[model samples]
Target: MMVSRRETLRLAALGTAAILASHPVAASAASKVRIGVLRFGTVSWELDTLKEHKFDATNGIDLEVVYFAGEDATNVAILAGAIDMIVTDWLWVSRQRSDGGDLTLAPYSTAVGAIMVKEASLIRTIADLKGKKIGVAGGALDKSWLLIQALARRDHGLDLPATSDVVFAAPPLISEKAIQGELDAVLNFWHFCARLEANGFRRLIGAEDAEKALGASGPVSALGYVFHDKWANENPDAVRGFLKASAQAKDLLARSDEEWLRLAPIVRAEGKELAKLRDRYREGIPRRPVAEEAADAGRLYRVLAVIGGEKLVGSTPEMAPGTFWQEPPK
Candidate 1:
């Protein structure tokens, strides 16, 4: 079989192209981004939706959603570069940024937490919380606790520790103890608060109300996607891709009740619990970046400073300039 030189060259080029197409290294590299998430975290819902919908794949993001038992573990992973990003609050981002850590945040959920009381309880207001046994989730350093402390100082002129018998406990235990009549009220995370509401507790004051009481005009982006600045600077497109997919997931949950119903089982919310979650998600969807929520960020900083004093996040009474990553890499 005699082959012409031109034909041999054509066949050789075709073979090379086929090999390149099949070779893993020669194929387009998929962007890998490891994200840390907690089991019961609401951002997990978005991640679940992203996975179920294949939004990450469609958006050209190879997301590795890593699970963590708690924020401390998650923070440790992030600091060690074992994970790239996590759903965390701006308060943490501010603290890290102020301390010269290379971390930044973009809004994930603006979900506001609440203080819930038993329906039959006589605690009608924050002032009435005086001397009552209260369960506080995430301990005395919890963001909600700090906000409540600020709220009390600003509106009622009473310190939270001086007013209430605060007990630091996990959220589920707080709910259980509240139901068993051991605690007068429970201040917990948003998801826990929603579950408590489903179980018949009433919100004494919501995060938004607390912010308002503290004279904040904008809705605080309480929770956001946090990542190391170095990684983000290196992989801008991947970060933007993640945000795009997440925004789509957030919008889907807000725009369609069907999406909520679909994700109910995965998120462990059923019936009334699911309904409450839908309402809360609708309310908490952040329409803009954290940079746009300046007033609320300032409010959060003030609250953190008030309750945590100089120990929590230093004496900086303002949101750190680079704390919120506003512009995505072009």
Candidate 2:
């Protein structure tokens, strides 16, 4: 009528095995992916969707979001092994790889900034920007600013920075100054540009347009999910799963206006501003093939190298090999 000790132990082992088999993710610690993100970054909208829709778990991974105050902090976190991935540009990945680091990127957003002007501003062409006060965010090395400069020189033979009163400041400050009429034109980040559009500002030229004018074939992603090659190779499944989850999230955001409404608070927008932000975010989603994007990036790199010099792209005049991560065949 009583079970033996050996039989009891066998039953316990079977029960534990059954539980682990039913929940595979709980059985493996490697399925957890820690991602570093900016505290106010738009990437959070997609990440929040992933969690809300349970995409990560469906993809067989636990997504952990780590927030930092700035981009540099996120970079430090990923490099110091505090997180698995962060959203950044391929240019940065190329720079790091050239300097003996193994970071790689998966395209995130093709959305880039624009040169914005007030509705009544006389700056209708690149030539009109001469002798005007302009504000630029992300400083002298800002990719969009550099691209705009190249565009001005190539198309109009004007040295934009040299001829204009250029002011470089934080994105928010630049946006504020432009609104206050302290600057005649401004080149700011995408989100800020969206806000400016909502407030009646006009886009003189978009970064994507500038790239095309400067010889790129199509829209190229300027930002992506960056991670170390060693870590990605070791956790291939987790990395792929996370990327799949991210893609699913983007699809949802693209198709659903209700989803954008839900994200309004996080994005700090409402009404016209919210709609503008949503539209711009959707527009920025990367749709080109990886190879196509990489080819454009290589061409764009040469242009940037000419202006940014050794300080911006390091010693590599070309985009480093493997700067864009190609998903392994299924």
Candidate 3:
């Protein structure tokens, strides 16, 4: 269920207190890093894996993960100082920095989303979407929605909002609606898109393609671990510890299918579900920077400026300096 904004703020204020009360540490104990996460998101998966392997203990940090219901709630918790870090998009990081806030992002996943339609649907191109009831997985301000608008303007000389009927809902509901023929197409997160595709939906386009059209040299990782710059500077070792553990977890998944088998229950993978999960994970695992990747962050800045406008990306269409945490703590 979606958390009410007020309830989210309440949780933000009380979450860490609740955790510390239940799991007390000495005043001079190891550094504790409180992270905000969605209860069912991929970050949650990583946290579970970290706990299962006791990676935090091994890395010498007392990590406390607080669960939020959605991205907005997580953002609120981070800004409220209830959590030191969160798994969120670089776009949000850009917004925060533009506001004189000191948040920075680190790479997490390069899982770009897709627009899906039924196997038998007649919508073969962006132009075909005119007057169709499309289901958007995130809010009206979602990146995917902006990308779609950008695509429409560039490719078909059409404004998506004026040309098509858009309905916003959660990814699961969007997928369900598509399956029931209630929606002509759904623009959803990559994993959900993969799941729907595995269930016989067809992909019309993906955000990677949209990025390319917007002049990105290649696909860019959007979601990342975001933290307050001051907090990160003060807790360099803890920051390094978290990254080390996260890299280890990613490496484990990349190296061993057995790891997925072990996590099958948590991921709820079975048969085709297992195959889709494996495909999505492998597709998203970060790699060494390619030449094309160098242009993505900047291109993303421009794309958001043009498509998302000032409301979503802030006053400047340019990416702020130091938006990314370049030097991993030594």
Candidate 4:
């Protein structure tokens, strides 16, 4: 039981080295999957995030996350190698695909995007959208498909009218713009959308309409896991794992508001009203996956071709196969 001083020093150094090795910050080298996700809420979700970093705690993803403010910025970050994958709206993915960007929908996420109109407005139906300016939080094509889908359901000729116009605005402000009478309608995801309803706006269209209207013959854009094809092909396992975990996270997020509430501080630290937003994204909205709707993916894409307004990624024709990542295992 007599340890020499030199031996103790040697053991001490080894212990220090071991401690350094286990440090989470250093252990998570940035070289891991740098998923560039959108920080949709004002609060930042991931900050130079690492894999398996417990957002849901259970079934967490093992990757790094770089939060981007919007789709355009997120795509730019992807090109710049700031991160590897993106989980954003499918419409953004469609725009990226049409623009010839190297991104693909390797997995399914959600399909809850919709269009809203003021209940009191004369634009009582999809056909009424003509000649009116619509504000879309995502973009024009999003509104076009929304109107197209809505029209297809109510009347066959009810596709996007050329006479209509679209204005780009933040998702949080879509309803506000409509209430102010500045926008005839709004197309957006659900977080603030429920608020619109509470404030008197009604749902003009939903994703189900996209499928019914297009009759499965066209491409429709919505939401999914968008990542660079080059990276996806090279790292299929990670892609699958990420998707699997995301799917699990989707379930977890649906079952409880605990995770969003726990992560609220990460958002509130930014001085943004994140708790309310978290409640908005969690309690007030629906969370579900769209893996079964591969057919709709193409339909959403075709709808984008009609808008032709945002060439975020590349030309329409270039938005072909080989760009879409294989559907993540269910």
**Order by TM-score, highest first:** 2, 3, 1, 4
lDDT of 1 by residue, 149-238 (tens): 787777788887977888988888988998898998888888889888898899999877877667667677777789887887777778
Name the candidate that leads on lDDT: 2
- Colliding residue pairs in candidate 3: none
- Stronger candidate by lDDT (2 vs 3): 2
Give the per-residue lDDT of model 2 (tens digit) for 198-248: 998999999999999888898999899999888888889999899899999
lDDT of each: 0.76, 0.86, 0.77, 0.53
RMSD of each: 13.2, 12.3, 3.5, 13.3
In model 3, which runs have C-alpha deviations exceeding 4 angstroms? 1-31, 290-295, 328-330
Q: How many residue pairs clash in each candidate?
A: 0, 0, 0, 24
Q: For model 1, how big is the CA root-mean-square deviation?
A: 13.2
10 residues in a row with least lDDT, candidate 1:
19-28
lDDT of 4 by residue, 17-62 (tens): 4323442333223224656556654213322121224532333335
Error of 3 at 41 (Å): 1.3
Better of 1 and 2 by TM-score: 2
- Give one digit per residue, the lDDT tens place, for model 3 in 128-199: 999999999878878877887888898899887887899989888988998999989889988888888789
